[model samples]
Target chain A: MISTHLPALQIILPLLAAPLCVILRNGTLTYWFAVVVAWLAFAVSALLLQEVNAIGVIAYKLGGWAPPWGIEYRIDLLNAYVLLIVSAIGALTVSYAKPSVDQEIGGDRGYLFYTAFLLCLAGLLGVTITGDAFNIFVFLEISSLSSYALIAMGRDRRALIASYRYLVFGTIGATFFLIGVGLLYQMTGTLNIADLGERVAAVGPNRTITVAFGFMAVGLAVKAALFPVHAWLPNAYAYAPSVATIFLAATATKVSIYVLIRTYFTIFHHDFSFGVMALGDIFMVFAVLAMLAGSAIAIFQTDIKRMLAYSSVAQIGYMVLGVSMATVLGLTGGMLHLFNHALIKGALFMAMGCVFYRTGSVSIESMRGLAARMPWTMAAFVAGGMSLIGVPLTVGFVSKWYLLLAAMEQNLWWILVFLIIASLMAIIYVWRVVEAAYFMPSSAGAPTDIQEAPMAMLVPMWVMVLANFYFGIDTKLSVGVATRAAKFLLGDAS
Target chain B: MEWPGLYNYWIAIFLMVTGLYLVMAPQNLVKKIVGLNVFQASVFVLYITMGKVTGGTAPIIAEGIEVYSNPLPHVLILTAIVVGVATTAVGLALVVRINESFGTIEEDEIRELEEAQEDAS
Candidate 1:
């Protein structure tokens, strides 16, 4: 009986745990409680994915009310896949957070951090599961608002400014999304996503729908940190506490991209969106720019966190490039990257978190001779960096191979060239850190007594690193799920 | 163009643009929050306007009332308004912290100080 309600339970478990953490009030208690809740949420999502695979789409009505009147939680293969990624990352990050949080944020504020982390996790899950358009906005705010609190809790005063800027950008993006939903409501008279899918085609091409599409596209693009509107990301990632950086880097923008995919292929219908509207051309231009520019900027950043953050921007470009092709292979590539990049980035940031736990800084200068001191953490960083550069044995190479095939399938040879160039650029930035850590002498004023990050941090960091290799070799799970989900998204769009 | 018939939309557009300008143009943190509130209020107006029906009364069921405005959009906006208020509260709290740390809420001055701190480090 309870198994039937796993979808709702997936969100409720974390949502309830968030407030419970606050009421618990002790830092250590809240941390352990949060870890348990996160792991349970992860288990629930694993079961939810199993259920989705066993019996097609699962639509659980809120309060037993039918759709088009009450809200609904619809889980197709695509979101089920994304839910697994988000929840898995959330579990890993929550488990990894305690030591990093204690080091940077101290014990007094640890409960609040765990509370916000739980809220953010619940919100991301809610955004993914809900079939209602307005519910996405509400859950989006729930996540966004908590994340601002999380980002602001960093020890750096600049974290304050970063959080504030993100607030402004994030609110505008969400309001733009709200505007889009309002316009769609005005036209379709329904808030259900499946309901909108049917009604939107009948409404056909109109000014309101077009404007709504534009609003939603731009809004979600900002949230996704798509190149030009991505000014808030680097600083936000750079200044946030290491634990927060790892979690947000892994999941926040990926969820935004999931919504973007929903809007483009599902509601608007790929026929209207890609064929008539020619959105692919527009996205292509920006995606290429993001690839070239984000990577170029990363090469120059002294701060390793900011460098990886910019690399994230470039990586988002790769995902968008796959999306713009609008082929099944292309969408598969996009979806796979969405999963793979989360692993790649989650592992990379965890390694960085380990570094930050030991060294008080993540600047390149601070990293000189780091490899000699902290061999295990440095080894993890190098492995994750190789993945970022698309080394053949890593998950990044698998996604890139698919994207290259998709580009070839479309006869878009220039995209292949750009992809290669971006990978080469990844090599340069990753090399910079490797050289600093492995080859260069310790810099003046750099701490000489740095040690390996503790077992609490190392175990989770290595788990992520190993998953990168494990998924890379066994493409059966990631590739199979992505291709199935892609086919479903394209075929299932009404 | 329907002219006066779509006056509410015109008003929404105007407020939205003004609010957007306020957010982008101002440097003071407090002003930015105010701008954010205004921007959110514009969305609230947009949603509420979407719910209105011609010659419609309140959505409460009655013996003879047939033309009632849709209550769903109103409900959604109520939630949105609560989110907006929460955002404002958080924004204000950050501004307080920013003031305590940086000693100024002006964006330019803050940036300058941050740059100096970066240089010194």
Candidate 2:
């Protein structure tokens, strides 16, 4: 009976907890409540993944109505994998949020911060679990709205502008998504994704459907911060509260990428999305640009958070590149990168959060001699950096290996060369931080007497850092799940 | 191309373009939020247009009614409108905060102030 209600409970736990956080109005209590709810959601996701592995796909109809007639919470290998990533990150981040948030945001607003945080978690989980097309947009808004508030809560005035810019772009993206959904519903009078898939194929190549696909792809691209439309991300990431930066950087865009995969592979099918629409070529070109441009721009940012934000754009490029490859190996690379990058970036951002808590700044200049003061945090950052640079025996290498194999399979030597060069570019930016944190003497303005971040922060951060190497060596959980999910997405069971 | 038959779509498209232009072309924060509202309203209109059947009545089911406007789009639009309103409220609240901090709500002025602060730091 409990297993049967896992789908509903996965979302409801966090959704209900958000209001409880507000009602409590005590910072410590609200934070503990959120952490408990997040961990509960994580457990539910793990159980759901297990059930999905046992059964094929678990579809829970809301109000006990069948699909195409009611909203459904559909859990397949794809979403189960994504759910684990989001919920795991949510749990870790909320636990880590206490000290980081207290230092950065401070005061009674802590209760409000946790409230928005829970709403964001619920929204993302809702987006992932729903089988209804319209429900995705609703949940997307829930997450996006809460994120705006969280970002605006930063101490700096720039944070307000950053939140505003993100709001404008995010609203436009969501509206475009809504228009796409409306267009699809017009063509096939169903809002359920499975029913739409069947009905859309039967409609067969209408101009409206093609345009609808374009709108949805572009909308998700904006949300995912792909290449040219990625203007909103760097500022939002750099200026948000440290904990918010970590949570949003790790999970929000990853969820958008999942939506992109669901739309192109599940609803539109590979042939329609890739072959008929010729999106593969476009995606490849933009992905390469994102890798080159994102890394290139990252090299110049003085702020460590902004630098990491740019690096995220590049990592997303790697993921999208794998998707654009349209091969089993390629998609495996993409999905693996999704999981791997979340771990790498989560650890990296958590390290940044720790630094900010100690120094009250995230500028590269402030980070000089940090390794001496906070060895554990800097060590974690170094490990995360190596993972970012695709150093061998790290999780980054595993995903990049799959991507390289996919490119080689297609005989795309040019793309192979670009991937290598981009990895090298990653080395340049990450080394900038390493050289500052480890080698340089303390700058005149840098704090001299700072200690390592609190155990609450370091523990969760190290968990992710160790996971980078642990999952790298033991590929069963991450790689095995990713490969299986990739095959399922590509409709290649064998 | 049946121009008259496709009139609703054309109107929706025009509104959408106008809204998108305003949002992009303006420096005033308030205008941008207004533009966003307009953009969302266009979407509502488009959805409503799609749901309309030629001789359809309101979607309440009765024994006499055979032709009914599709109710799904209406439901979807209603939810979307609520989302739009929430977004507007948040956007406006942000603008108010921006004004209080920087003494201006113009995008360019805020950027200049930020640049000056960065230089001073």
Candidate 3:
């Protein structure tokens, strides 16, 4: 007799756990409690995903009211995948946070850090689980607020500025998103996304609807760090605490991409203003620019964290490429890439955290001969980098393969060329670290002796890297579900 | 367009664009955050106005209530408003931290200092 309210509890459990972290006020206790909550959330997400897979779709009306009247929570394959991503990242990072956070943040701020972490984890989970559009906004704010705080907690002074830039851009993004929602409500008089979809389909081709569509599209584009609007990302990731960087990098923009997919392909039918022409053409252009520009820029960065941060932009291009294709396989590639890139980047950033933990810096030049010093950490880095380069037997390769197939399906051979060129650029950037850390002599500040990161960090880091390999070969978890989910979304939108 | 039908939206757009410009173009972090607040407030107004039906009254649970504009948008905006406040509080907290560490809230000055530090390092 487990009810569908379990989805709400999955999110609320973490949200409620944050305050307890504050009251406890001990870093160790708070950290462990957060980890437990995250694990519990992961279990809940698994159960929800299972329930959805068994049933057609699980829709629960809040407060026992019917949809189109009251808020609801929908658990389908699409969001179930997202729920798994955010909650799994939450669980892993909190498990990995003990050593990385201890090294990066001060003791007095530790409890507060875990509190913000829980809120963020809850926000992301809530965003994935909610069926109501307004609920989406509420959860988005919860996540965004915690993200800003988490970024600002960096010991470096640059963290403040990075957080500020993120705040400005993130706020603008959220505002535009709200304006779009407002316009849709004005026209349709419903805040439920499922209801809005029905109403919008009933009354189409209006000026206000078109404008609202634009606003939400652009807002989500910015939030997803698409091309020109991604300026806030590198600095934010670079300056944030390592645990926060890994968590936010792996989940925040991915969830934003989820929102983008949901909006364009779910709430607004494909027949809207751009339909195929504008939506496909615009996203294709931006995805190409982001792919090349992000890789080119990443190649020049001296800082390891900054390089990975830029690489995230390039990876986002892969997801958007699938979106631009506007086919089921294309959307499948996009959604699966969203899940895959999170795995790769989470591992990469955690490796950086290991470096930060030991040497207290992530500058490439200073990382000379790291393979000799911290063999396990460098091995994790290499594995993650290979996945990023789209080597076979890795999640990254599977995603890019599908994306290439999608582009081929659309008969866009040039995008295939562009994607390969971008992967080459990724190689150059990734090679810089390999040469610096594995070949060159250690730099001036390099410790005479290098020590591996603690068990807490190393174990979680390897788990993600291994998951990348596991899912790459299996393909069932990442590919099968994404394909089905894409069909559902594309069919529903049409 | 009627006297106030579509034209009201025109005003909302103006205020929104102006607020967005302030948030994006300003060099001062505090001013930028203030601009963000303004921008979000404009959105709230847009949602409220959108909820207002021509002859409809406030949506209420009354005996034999006949017509109400729409309470859904109003409820949605309430959630958005709380989110807006939370964002403001986080922004102000960051500004306070920045002022403490760098002794300034000006974006350019902060960037220049960071550049210098990067160079020296």
Q: Which scores better on DockQ, 1 or 3?
A: 1
TM-score of the first chain alone, every candidate: 0.99, 0.99, 0.98
- Write model 2 residue lDDT over A330-423, tens digit each, in one string: 9999999999999999999999999999999889889899899999999999999999998988999999999999999999999999999999
- Each candidate's lDDT (Cα)? 0.93, 0.94, 0.87
Model 1 segments more than 4 A misplaced? A492-494, B1-3
What tens digits encode model 1's per-residue C-alpha lDDT throughout B1-121? 5657789888888899999999999899999899888889999999999899989999888998889999999999999999999999989999999999999999999999989988876
Name the candidate that leads on DockQ.
2
Question: Which candidate would rank higher by lDDT, 1 or 2?
Answer: 2
DockQ of each: 0.86, 0.92, 0.84
lDDT of 2: 0.94
Q: List the candidate 2 regions with Cα displacement exceeding 4 Å.
A: B1-3
**Each model's interface RMSD (Å)?**
0.5, 0.4, 1.0
Scored against the true structure, residue A106 in model 1 reaches a CA lDDT of: 87
Q: TM-score for all predictions?
A: 0.99, 0.99, 0.97
Q: Which number leads on lDDT?
A: 2
